[model samples]
Target chain A: MILSDLVERFGHHPLGIGQEIGRMVTTPGLDNPPLNITEKELTRGLRYVAVEAPSGIRGRMGVLGPLVEQAEAAIVVKNADYAFGCSGCARANIQLIYMLRRKKIPTLEIEYPKTREEAKVMVKRVVDFLRGLGGTNG
Target chain B: MARIAQISCGTEWSGIQDLLEKAANMVGAELFFPEVDLESIDKAVEEVGVNAQSPNLRLMTARAKAVVDGAPAEAVLLLTCFRCAEGVITKHAIRRYLQEKTKIPLVMYSFTEKPKLGELLIRLEALVTLAEKKALLARERQEGITLGIDSGSSTTKAVVMMDNEIIGTGWTPTTTVLDSAEKVKREALEQAKLNGRDIEGIGVTGYGRFLLKEKMSVDLVQEELTVVSKGTAFLANRQRGEAMVIDIGGLDNKVMTLLNGVPDNFTMGGVCAGSSGRFLELAAARLGVDVPTLGKLALRGDPERVKMDSYCAIFGIQDLVSGLASGVSKEDVAAAACRSVARQVFETQLQEIDLRQPIIEVGGTSLVDGLVKEMGEILNADIVVPRFPQFGGAVGAALLVSGVV
Candidate 1:
């Protein structure tokens, strides 16, 4: 919530997968029935994955690729347990992180909070990272 | 206020609120996060079946119990993370369970720690729009003088309808969204020999629907998913029973299955424009012929003669260049491009659809006779082309807005 407030304050929209999937599931008359995603959106997703990837990658990419496209900057959490964040399709997750790196956008990699003390440090790091993006769009 | 039931594992554990307040406030929706005790989690795990030994997954299903137990939820968001294998499998299970178990609208999202706020606002806005404008989606008939404007990626289209029959249609290449909309709207009105004063209702749709609102008097603003199917059905005169509708437009393609003019399933977009009418336009530019001429020449050649089966527009064009350099006939090259687009749409979109008989093909590219023929041949089905296919979105918007007006 603090991060969201900060992102909003910084004049940048936060690009998240949840909202993209929500758009997909709610989008009327999409080709991906049972999920509300369009085939064209799926094709956009398909462009991200190599042809030789596993079958389920299409659906995941279809959700993630749009968010990545909207991102001006990214904040990736490092050293978080598998339990602390979204670990959707493992293959897609790794590739998406790699994609963020390759994008060469302003990125801040913070260690996940483990303790009360570590949590404070993480917040300070986040504040600094966001401040560093001053005068720059996220 | 609209109420959303959130079914999730580890949302709080991820240390984000899912921007709960922000999303809810944006949509004027009330968000609910149900809690399950350890006892309830244990009992629920049996029915949930597969959990990655993650209590979070178990708790997630337990949380879903509220909806099944008859809680008032206007929508449901099934959330998991991107990396949780067990959670993904479990999320799918919960999805199948909820789908089979309930009729509530379900939205699935994978959240990361510190998710972006703008994206969530967009989702919430869609939910609000779906709820508020639902009347536009389920209208069964149209009456009176109504106008619809469709501002698309490549073209602007307008249709004037009177008493359920299309009186006039205006089409122009899209340049400025508002200007193009006004031009097409004026053209349509001119053709109908009716001034704007005769129109009782006006609706706008497509990529520029919202833009028109600031400049025009609009009664309905709708998404193409429901409106397009409604339009196609009305145009094809297939408003009852089961049918499939395909629209190959200047930018994307839309394929939908409907029962009684309501879409139960549909997809909008090809793998790329290579699989859409835009590719046909590009192919015509390359072949030094108009789109209609390309269609005529395509009819004269065998599709199997020149190999240009690329489904990506850039690569598809490269294939066209390669085929031409190799001394392939222009007629054969046109046929291959048409057939290639047809084949790509078939492989990428149609394969996943529950195809109904009497496939109705609409949109500008539907007029390209050879592409239509190839698609018909590829599917072994007769493709129905409604009169004035290009104004499908316009017609649909006009038809749907009539309900509200």
Candidate 2:
């Protein structure tokens, strides 16, 4: 399913339920549905050839490295709240983020809270972003 | 008469034979030993294949054909030693073969001491006469005087030439490039035994050249491309067309296209220190090898690079540390660093520039053997590193001063 569809179905809450699930589920070690991604698709998406980066900052920053390798295509993730909130991780992700932005990757950073308890509200935010709910935000 | 072939050694697909040949010609030596591989002798200084024949006489018989075909009697190979001085010579056993095979005398001249271009030319002139080639010396004819200055982000280089004869050259950090230019100009004048008033004109080029010229005066300021093309042509000392000029400075990188002594087009990278001079320096530090020796170590590695994901200097360093902790071969890691830098340069900056012909790489980074090899492998193009690649821009500026630009 398209990320937008998933975002609209559960992203309407301010608790960021949809955004948190997206992060946790997409993370390599985390348990999530949609584990059927193919080897070819993974190879196509492989930008970071070396998986030496530690899981935290390196993982998020490295996310773009592999994407850049594959056709230099744009990969948009909605995490506006995380964008402003992530502190030390910012340094690691800054260059990749800037490169993605400068390359005009159609990026949409959606805001979500850090704690899992805020899930309901975060879901609403994701839904709002996915549905093009606000004129100025889009 | 002694015949010598001068060649500059680096770890790469090809040796800087032309640079050495030019040096030999400068010293009035007519004979040169064809390059040889010294791989079997594991005890030999690591990767000393090209150096064995440079500044050393190879077997005379191997060069008999060249001698019969009008090559010089003594082949004096020139080399810039990473461990020692600018030039070092290792006499190869080929000298015996040369003496046995041909009637011509063979000799090698290694300059361990740093000598400016003017001093080098005078020594060459004297050596030519000493080799009893007065007639050849008279007919050799020196090229005109040309001056080139590259005001790089970190270093400033100046090369002077007169009638194809490199007269004098100088290099210093960009932080003090203006001062270095002034100091080197004076030094060149002193070495040439000519007053500053003797200079008919001067030309400046490079990223910081514009800013430098504002503080210091010059007769001309050609763009980086034109000066680089002219400098490469001068180093070739003959027809140099359809060549790529890669100038790696401390902060930025430039790739230029030369079509018959003129710059046709060019590309430049961002002013980031990540994939340029600073990157090499940082990697070398991380590896604990001196920057100059970094290339030779890298030449020892197999094909696969260290496989670091990020090209950024900071993350790359961290990755290098982690790789070393995991027992990755230092040489492989170094080679990988070179590959990473080369990939960025070609893919992002020189992507559109043609890589069909052998590329003549200039600038400070050109001195690195590993980067040269990795660049060739990645680009799948023949790469030629001139003997004094660092001075290409400076020499081009000097050429402009002589009206060649």
- Top-DockQ candidate index: 1
Consecutive 10-residue window with the lowest summed lDDT within model 2 chain B: B84-93
Query: Per-residue lDDT of B105-222 in model 2, one digit per residue for the tens?
Result: 2223333234344334433433343345323212222245545677766787776666766777777776666777787676666666677666666778776666667987676665
In TM-score terms, candidate 2 sits at: 0.49
lDDT of 2 by residue, A14-126 (tens): 32323433554577853435532332223322232111122343344333344443423232333545434232343334434434544553345544456776656655645
Recovered fraction of real interface contacts per model: 0.00, 0.00
Q: What C-alpha lDDT do the candidate models reach, one value each?
A: 0.75, 0.54
The alpha-carbon lDDT assigned to residue B229 of candidate 2 equals 64
* TM agreement with the true structure for every prediction: 0.63, 0.49
TM-score of chain A of each: 0.77, 0.33
For each candidate, give the TM-score of chain B: 0.78, 0.62
Candidate 1 residue spans exceeding 4 A from truth: A1-138, B1-71, B75-101, B105-136, B350-353, B377-380
